[model samples]
Each structure stands twice: as structure tokens, then as C-alpha cells.
Target: MIKEIAILVYPGCMGMEVFALTDLVLMANHLAKNMHPGKFSALRVKLVTLRPNPVAIAGGFKVAAQRLRGKPDLIVVPGLEVSRFGEWDERFARLGQELKAIRRFHGQGTELASVCIGSFVLAEAGVLQGRRAATAWPFVSEFQDRYPDVQIEKDAVILSDGGVTTTGAVSSVMDLGLHLIRESMGSAVARAVSKLALIDGGRVSQRAYVDTALIPQNRAPFSTQVNRWLAQRLSETYNLCALADAFNVTSRTVLRRYRQETCMTPLQWLQKARIEKAKHLLELSSMSVAEVVVAVGYHDLATFSRLFARETGQTPGHYKRLFQGKRVATFPRG
Candidate 1:
């Protein structure tokens, strides 16, 4: 089956995911033709616009887009490069035609999809209204404010709900590509594409990319103070009694309120804060895994490793390597 995909391009669309996803689908086409000619065929893909003009993208690049001809099997709304926090309004003001097209296609039962903040576009078009969508972690607040009717999940890397599929972050483009292949082309072909393109298919969350310090913690005065206190004492052993005394609240009241605010108890919140700090130190400092464990209040190395893996789906060492480490330039000393 030939899956026709229309990549909706707009001014200031992020170019990386657009190019990466197109490349992946093209590779899948090649592999599918060679491997299973009788079963599957080349997927038809087109960069499309409401008008027959070159759409400006990020990095000052432009893509020649064909006038949208027909309702495609899938319409992919590409993420925009938001220079300012409140640019969603500006973006939508210019995308009146694009939004109409999306609404038209979706009403006709065509599936809708998005990459990163492209979910915002779908939300604006009302296709994602009252449906859950996977969105970029950092922009959840803005998305909620704009589209309070839509439910957003920040952790999921890829989500399919109510005939709409969405992915988190810019890098989730490959994950989305692989998911489409697995759903339409079969797992065997998806595995082949994964290996051929060297794209990791194991990513399931945006947790690794999250910065805990950035999460809004000031909804209530008590939660704000608790977060601040926790941030400073991540290296200390978790003591519920001491926390209650410091806040002048009873131990039971502390646990109940913290859980009510964060959906996590005091101990669980402490653990999360510690893991986030450990991730930060590993990415930015020259700290060894053992040192990181100690710095985060974990006494046992094996326990810390297991906890880290459970929390982020990657070992501390692997996470550090995947992020950054203190390493000198090859063949040159600093």
C-alpha cells in the first residue's frame, strides 16, 4: 500500500525534523521495494502548502511546496521555530489557510499527525480538541494556556489517540517515522529501516531531556518553599520528620499536601529532585558515576544504577555518554 503523506510547511518551520522524516520514509521505500516488492510499495510523500510558493523554514532556508492537491493518507504538521514565547498567535494569524486545510482533511476522516510543537498547530485547528496529544516538554504550559480543552502528555515520545498521532521534542521525528513504518509497513520492515538508518527505536519518553529545575513549582506558597528547600538539600538523606519540622507542619500534613500538589510524596519528590541533579552534574561536570551517586544522597552504587535506569530508561554512564562528558579534543591537550 502506498501511504500518501503531505508534509505541511509554513514560514519558520523547523527544518531538521522535516528533512529527517522525509529521509527516513525514503529509505523505507527503498528497503520495502527491495525486501517485499509484492507486499508493500513506495510511500508517496509531498511537501505541500496552501499556495504554490516557497515556504520559509528555520535557518533561513526555503522549501518549494506544491499546492495541496488532494486529501493525503496523512497530513504532517511540522513544528514551527518559535522565536518568542507568545508567537503562537502570530503563527496562527498567518496560517489561516493551512488551518482550514487541516480542518477540512480531518473532517473527511484523514488521519492527522504532528512533530514536537506541531501538535500546537493541530490543536489550533481543533482536531486535537478534547483528545490527548504528546507534546514538547518545555512548552506544556503555553499549550495548556492556549488549548485548555486538549490534554497534553509531556513524557510520551509518541502517542496515537483519536486518529491523531503526535510526538515529543524535535528528535522524536525518527521515532515517529519508525512508528508509522511499524504500523503500516510491518515490524520486519521497521526493524530493517531502523538498522539501515541507525535510528534508535527504544526512546519512549522525554524524561531524559527534562530539566527538573525548569518545572513550575510556584503554584502554592507551601509547594514553592518545599521545592526550594528540596533543591538545596538534594545531597542530604530524606527525612520526613525534619521536613515537617522545618516547614512547621505535622508530618502527616506535609506528606498529604506535597502529594496533593505534586502527585508525589515527600520521599518520592526528593528522589526525583536528586536524580535530576545527578543528571545535571553528569552532563555538565567531570563527575564519575560513583561521585554522582554520593552527591545525590545514594550510598550504594548498584542501587543508584538501578534507580537511575528505572527513572530515565538509561544507565547513568550511558546517559552521560549520550549527553556530554569532560573530554579533551582528540590528539590535543587543553
Candidate 2:
């Protein structure tokens, strides 16, 4: 039987999420039909929308999807562009109708999958209740607070439980689609599709891509003060006591406020800033690994290297080489 995959697009949806999954699914179907001949069945993918009208997305373009027709085998909900904290709440609030639709489709046995912040919609629909899920890292804390019963795996590239699959960040759309293809069409077809799509088949975590500095700025007053202080001195050693003294607060207060804002301890945040600076130096400067380590405020080379590897999933040297425009791998020209 041909598996039906319905990708739901919405107003302000992130186009990359929708297209990435759609293209991968289409490629999987193509590879299955051509290579395996009659050995495997193909997949039918549809761009579905709640309303039949054209919808404007994050980019400047508009898309028109078929008004969700009959229930499909799976429903992939793509995320929207959320640049502010309130945007998350606002989007879900305005999605009452869409939420109802999702619950209805799920009740009819349609499996639900979400990409990036799309998991928020699944949670709002109550489909992710009592299930393990994942979403873009920045929203993990908030998602947890809103859906207390749902388990959020912030680092996982893709997570599935009880027919509800959730993927982290926009790039995970490819990984999630490939996962589904593998499950339905077998590993062989999944590999063929991955190669055809030029995506890594082994990507299973989003930790390497997450930049702690790029995590949305914390809005709390104390967090803001701490952010300013850290920005000015990422290359210097800092102590929580000194920071608290400088800000006229107790050490515990500093820790509490920073944790509330960034979801990391003061020391962790300092390390994150230093590592981010080190990355910039590695990518742009002629400094050696040892020089780069000291430049990022680490006096001990071993400690810096270990911390860098742990946070980035790559050694300092490997990361430099990877980002220095060196060709790590070459693919046949399309």
C-alpha cells in the first residue's frame, strides 16, 4: 500500500521545514520506485493547509496547499518563525482551529510528527501528552513548562513515542523525514534517498549545531546585566562572587537569575561564551590550538580541549579544519 504523507503548511510557517521534509519524502519515493522496482511501494506526499487560501510564510513567498482532505497515514506540522518570546504563545493561541483539526486527524489514527517549534502545536493539541518529544533547543524549557506531562528531549535530533514523532530545530526536518522513510521503506531505500538528498544519514543530535550565544537573549533585568558583563569580558576568568559583588547582589541571586534567563549556570554560561569566542578565532585567525585556547581565557590546554570537544562534538583542530573552508568531503556534481 502506498503510504500517504501530508505536510501541513500555515501562515508564517518556516518554509525550509516544509520543503525539506517534502523533498526528502519525494526523493525516497522516487528511489524506491526506480531502484527496487516492484520490491517496495511508493509514498504519496501532499502539501496540506487548514484553509484552501494562499498562506504567507517566513520568507516573502506565498503557498497554497490543498485543504486537508481525507486523513493521511502521517501528518507533518512545520514550525513558524518565532523571533520573540511572546510569538510562541501568540501562535498557539491563534491556532485554536488548527489544533482542533490536528486532534481530529489524530483521533482517526493519523500519526503525528512535528518539526522545530511545530511540536508546540502538537502539545497544544494534546497529542503529545504522556509522550517523549523533542523541539528546537531554545524553547525546551518553555515547552516543558507548558506541557508538564510531556517529556522533552532537548538534544535529540528526532524523538518518537506512541506514534508521535518530534524533531529538533529546522534542520532536523531532513533527519525526521529520512527516519520515516527508513521505517516504512527499509534501510536500503533510506540510504539511497539520503545520498540523493545530500544529507548526512548519521545525524542523531543537534547539540553540535546549537550555539549557546545565539540562544535568545534573556529578558530578566539581572540576566540582562549579566549578559552585558559577560559580553565585555568573555576572555577573562570570572567568579560568581565577583560577579554578584559587581552587580550588588548575592552569589545565589546571580545564579538564580542567570539560570532563569539562560537555563544554564553562570560558570556554564561563561564557558559557553569563551568557547564561542574560541570558535570565531579558530575559524578566522591563524592561531594554533594552544594559542586559541589561551586566547579564550583557558590557561590549561587539556581542560579547554576536553570542554570544547564535549560541547561541540569535535576537537579544536578538527573544528578549525572543518570551518576553514577546507573541503572535508567531495560529492559528485548534480
Q: Estimate each model's TM-score.
A: 0.81, 0.85
Q: List the residue pairs that clash in candidate 1.
A: none
Estimate, for each residue in 1-334, the C-alpha lDDT of model 1 and write its tens digit: 3389888888878998788889988988888888888788677788888765777788788789888887789988889888766678877898888899899999999998899999998999999988999899888888888999988886889999978999999989999899888877899889999998878898888877887566545477677688788778888888888889999999999988887776777677778778888998899989898999999999999998888888887899999998985466687567
Worst 10 residues of 2 by lDDT: 209-218
All candidates: CA RMSD (Å):
3.9, 3.8
Q: Cα lDDT for residue 301, model 1?
A: 91
Error of 1 at 203 (Å): 2.1
Whole-model Cα lDDT of every candidate shown, in order: 0.85, 0.84
Backbone clashes, each candidate? 0, 0
Q: After superposing candidate 1, which stretches have Cα over 4 Å from the reference?
A: 37-39, 84-86, 213-229, 238-269, 284-288, 300-310, 315-334
Q: Give the TM-score of candidate 2.
A: 0.85
Candidate 1 Cα deviation (angstroms), residue 88: 2.6
